[model samples]
Target chain A: MEHSGKPNKIRLSTNPTNEALSKLKIGDIVYLDGVVYTGREGVYMRAIEDGEPIPMDLPAESAANFHCSPAAVQNEDGSFNMGAVTATASFRFSKWIGAWFKMSGAKLILGKGGMSPEDYKKHFVPNGAIYLTTVGYGTGALLGRGVKQVRALHWRKELGLAQAIWVIEVENFGPFIVESDLEGNSLFERENAKIAENLSKAYEGTRPAVLKRFGETDDRKDELI
Target chain B: MISIDLIQQTAETLMDKAAIEIPDDYLDGLKKTASQEDGDLSSFVLQAMLENYQAAKEDRRAMCGDTGCPRWYVKMGNEAQIEGGAIALEAALRRATANATNGVPLRPNRVHPLWRTDHDNNVGIGAPEIEYGFEPGGDWVDLITVHKGGLFGTDYRMLFPSDGIEGIKRFYLDCLVAFGKRGLACQPAIIGIGLGGSKDTCMVLGKRAACLRVVGDKNPDPKIAALEDEFKELGNSIGMGAMGFVGKSMVIDCNIEVGYCHTGGMQMSVHAFCLSSRRAVARVFGDGRVEYRTDPDWFTDYQRRDTVEWNIPENQTKSA
Candidate 1:
């Protein structure tokens, strides 16, 4: 178990070399090297609704064309970086799709906004998936690092930017903090618990009248003017 | 009789001039703000402000590429007469659009909602928005140019009055949680708030209000000003650590714009202009005198940070 650049001992559903992921418990820092797909709001929605297959053949430059396959992160070490393949904002999509992502063989999800605690623990962890995020709106800079690859999948023509799927090879990808793992523990859940605790304390400090004021509805038509 | 062609030509010239003409006042203001914002958030804001100046000066590019659909808000005198005022205004805008597309290479942002067709020249149905106001004794038309920067994404957070005090706190907390979760989302971004309006108007005002701030300038309304302060404090308290864990500054400025609303409920909208609230404005009078508005320190700061000498290009410095 080399500690230098390997992923901290975690379970992975898929093996680095085989299509079928094998169970591994060794505490090895696995630097991810393989084909990863990129998708965002538009891409996720279209695929879920239309049952479209992810395009794995399109070039990286045309990722924006399908809305789902435009972005990729190349590691500084010449390996497929998991920098930008995090999950799309999961809350925006239906719950059923979480399982769909697992079925699609998407080993890593990269996005800024986190997902529901239950969903990550239940769906992502058991399925051997990981989440990562990049600097938001740093797409311009991030994209600058992307090497254009051939598109592996395409879909409806009417979908334009929303229509294709691309399989990208990334390298030396990340220093991403793990929010959820195969064990089902999550950072988001911990944070939410703290928020809930704080809210409760604040509520206890407030008087009933003040709490009532919070409930008072202002229906005045003049307020808007 | 001046034909629409002349108006079109003049409008095009003004737009082109507006694109490059960096106002002395704006440059100075930017520099001042950058110098003062020694804090974690202000630094990034200052850097963003300076970057805008550099990009504009180096490439002679429009400060913000969006350069929002050309808009002309004109006040006409009651007694003023023209051969073809409306048509001239239209043609002038058309010409301006053409010039901007080629000269600035601005993004063709205009698209039909339903058809999704690109208005190749940044022109669309009733676009390059122009609004008219009439004054009884006014003698000349006064023109103002406004360019909007950035787009709406995870960088911004919108809050409503109904969101409650707890909700407000939660909103800020949520942003931090999101930032922590996603790494750094957007930094040196301008935080714009539209306090009260219809849903659509709230969003629009949020964007407009963000655009109104003069770099480091604070809001005038005491209540709203206080809210801005709270937001700033809460944002820093999270220790997102400037630029999402990096030592760079976090937010540049928080601008609040409030409007009267018919709906009893408050609708708050927020827009984040990523470290590049690249915006520029110009006022052109009928007498051919032009005044550009931007913070003056902007120029000095650019010189200081980029170590580039600040010289108002001779061609651009001349009075319009």
Candidate 2:
């Protein structure tokens, strides 16, 4: 397939600097090596919007955060079993992504479905951060395979494992799309506009048949049988 | 007679299978659609999905972290005997649900609407929700368990009797457009349309449609089946392929099930199932024997097609 460029590799032990990320373009696939905390639902909101202290030291491990709340289970002793890592919609969790970028020293946000055009323009471009989307469904194995370790540190009781912050280590974690790039491009917006035009054209072609079969009024006879 | 323990064991098996494995029809259908899709980005996405499917299978892991709340449709023979009554059967299913939560380590997805509290085990009031149907004979319970994802939920719309056939068609097309633009519901999704029933009946039909085999069958009615074909073709025209990246194969399948409606109005519902489409089937016999079913053969009188109709125009191109 047409990659924006080669699949560039970034190790999390030494996280890729903005200069390294700037060279990447929208549509580029990436593989990351490092640690990302799983805290998308509410804890992230607390850290990003409420000025609350992060459950763990994110900047020290890597500023990268995967928008995932894993499917871990508790043992009889109340400890957690290793669960699957799956990404959720980033747009829903990104109200403070700009602030997240500034405050958390974030460089990359990976999840399913990219953000709005406004979010990309306002935060991602100016901050030199990039947004990526992984496969949404049928992807727990892909996610599960990437994870090397999982340590639950916060919110197990309140949010359950699905919405808690579980610090995880990974090696070459990826198959993600550069949905929004540092170059001020939002792939999601571009594709949205394109799909809208195609749908209109398609509707134009099918209106006649639809009208003929089911229409109450046949005003568009010119396009019909 | 099927014992309560057998029923619980059967439910557990079905849930585990549905969680860890991608059904054969859906997996094959996706590969076929991916090969037909002609775009680098979209195809890449599909390939990645296939990879994940394989990984989940070989690694014995779940396809998605959202193991989803359990929903089932059970078809039993009129002569079938259960050691315990209907409540006992339901209790067994609830036990199985709890087992699946620990065994699959399924995410605690069930939350009380008012309390917003995590049920932890995923079994709650009226939970592991079961719908029942009875057949004329056979002394067995035919069951299929479906897993519903978070984004594409069960949606219903009420159309007055005056909003006739054209209106129904328009409503479906409009919904497809909205689904395409929003990307809230992932594309290359399975669309289930229920027509003419009361609100609840229409919704149940829609859910049943989503749980049916992708390439398996259509309604027995010729006129209704034709409408289904048309809907499938038109739905693909929006081109929301593989996570709304804009390609030819927007939908894997469109299932339409119709019901008799009242004189006042028609109730319509549309259910979107992502590529995961996780479901598993089983049959529990009177001898307390249980057999797991791999293919989701939900419909009996289905009219099979040669190509599962998707009309992709030749030599047409634009933005993606």
Candidate 3:
């Protein structure tokens, strides 16, 4: 749990079908050094519906658009291009965890916004899964971390950038918080419940002027009309 | 007759003046927030932001490249007459907008919804978003222009109107919680809360509030002042810390602007600007008079010292 120069590490195995879900803990820090596929909103939705392959490599023309190269790729300066691979928002793809684990062997999820099903905390803790939230609106800072390689697997080319799976090598890709752990405590759920509760209280308490002006309800009563 | 050419020229001048005037207040607020806190991370972020401001000022570059949708608030006098009226006003705005885009070298930020074409000068369908109001006594128009600087990420996406008065408190908390969850490491960021408008309009108002001067400055309404204080306290208490990781202060100032709403519905929009809340307001009179205004206390140490590279056009003279 102490901070070292290297990223926090977690070991994941995929020999058995259920191994991916069985090995995770509630609050374990994980560093996924191996290759993992990347998918965002549209790709995840399509994958869940059609079971498509995510592409792992960018075309030669597309490669030039990359902000950084893969860690294995070297520049004229002889330094590793360590790019941070961010996971897309969790809520957009929360329902596809089973499919993602089945295909990609993804051990870590990196993103900014929180996830759903407040009780997923226990699911994460016991299953060796973790959700890490990167800083919001700091894509430049995240991109500055560098890139070594871009890889994708099993996605339609027509989908263009949105469908490709990005396998990026990141250095110390953290300062992220665990929203869901193997123990099933979901930060997103906790936050939403708090929001819903506060919203309910506010709804019951205030009688804004607009409500009276609009006559309160849509129900058409003869007397009011 | 109001000339479109004249309005365009005025808009350009207003934008140029805004660019140099706004960053100082933002930088000062960031520094003040960081100094009040007791943490290494918060301090580091603040220092970095200050450096960012310095570099931007030195190069005469933008504090943050986003330089969001330029918003214009126009107040016209009932007695004031435009030769072409709204048409003249629109032409003036478009001209000023084009000038600003070229002059600032501003990023072509606007995009067409269906076509997705970049409006190279930050002008697009319903863009350089303008709001119009009329005052009874004036013979001319007064324009307040604000260009907000920040990344429009999830913060822009999370806005929802409150169902009722009770919704106001929740809306307030939602903003703070959203900031805590996703905000940067810097504290004392400007929180703009707009209550009552259509969904999009409310959000724009929230951003406009952020682009306005800090609280304890000037706002016409006392009710708004009270709400600002309440929200500020509530937001700071979230323990989101500087930059929202965990710290004593979460925001430097909270500004709330209330607008008229239709019956039975109230909307609240919240926008958070990072510690560097770059904002400038210009008051232009009917007779071609213009004055630049900033929060008096902001960047007090740096006031009256022209460290920023402000290339005011030599031909254009400042009104006395």
For the candidates in turn, chain A alone yields TM-scores of: 0.53, 0.78, 0.53
**Scored by Cα lDDT, where does model 3 land?**
0.49
Task: Report the poorest 10 consecutive residues by lDDT, candidate 2 chain B.
Answer: B311-320
Residue B115 displacement (Å), model 2: 2.9
DockQ of each: 0.08, 0.33, 0.07
**Better lDDT candidate (1, 3):** 3
What lDDT, from 0 to 1, does candidate 2 have? 0.71
> For candidate 2, lDDT tens digit of each residue in B1-320?
87878888888988888888888877877888888877667777788888988888887778887777788877786678887878898788888888888888777778777776777888887777888876545678877888877665456678876666666766676656555543556667778888777888889787777776565467777888787788777777666667767676667778888777888877888888876788888989998778787655666532222245523224322210
User: Which candidate leads in lDDT?
Assistant: 2
Which stretches of model 2 miss by more than 4 angstroms?
A: A1-14, A48-51, A77-80, A205-225, B160-165, B295-320
lDDT of 2 by residue, A121-147 (tens): 888778767787776444777878887
Candidate 2: pairs in clash = A12-A33, A12-A34
lDDT of 1 by residue, A143-206 (tens): 2223234334344244332223445444443223344545555544443343333333323322
lDDT for position B94 in model 3: 70
lDDT of 2 at B216: 45
Question: TM-score of each model's B chain?
Answer: 0.65, 0.88, 0.74
The TM-score of chain B in candidate 1 is 0.65
What is the TM-score of model 3 when looking only at chain B? 0.74
Give the per-residue Cα lDDT of candidate 2 at A132.
71
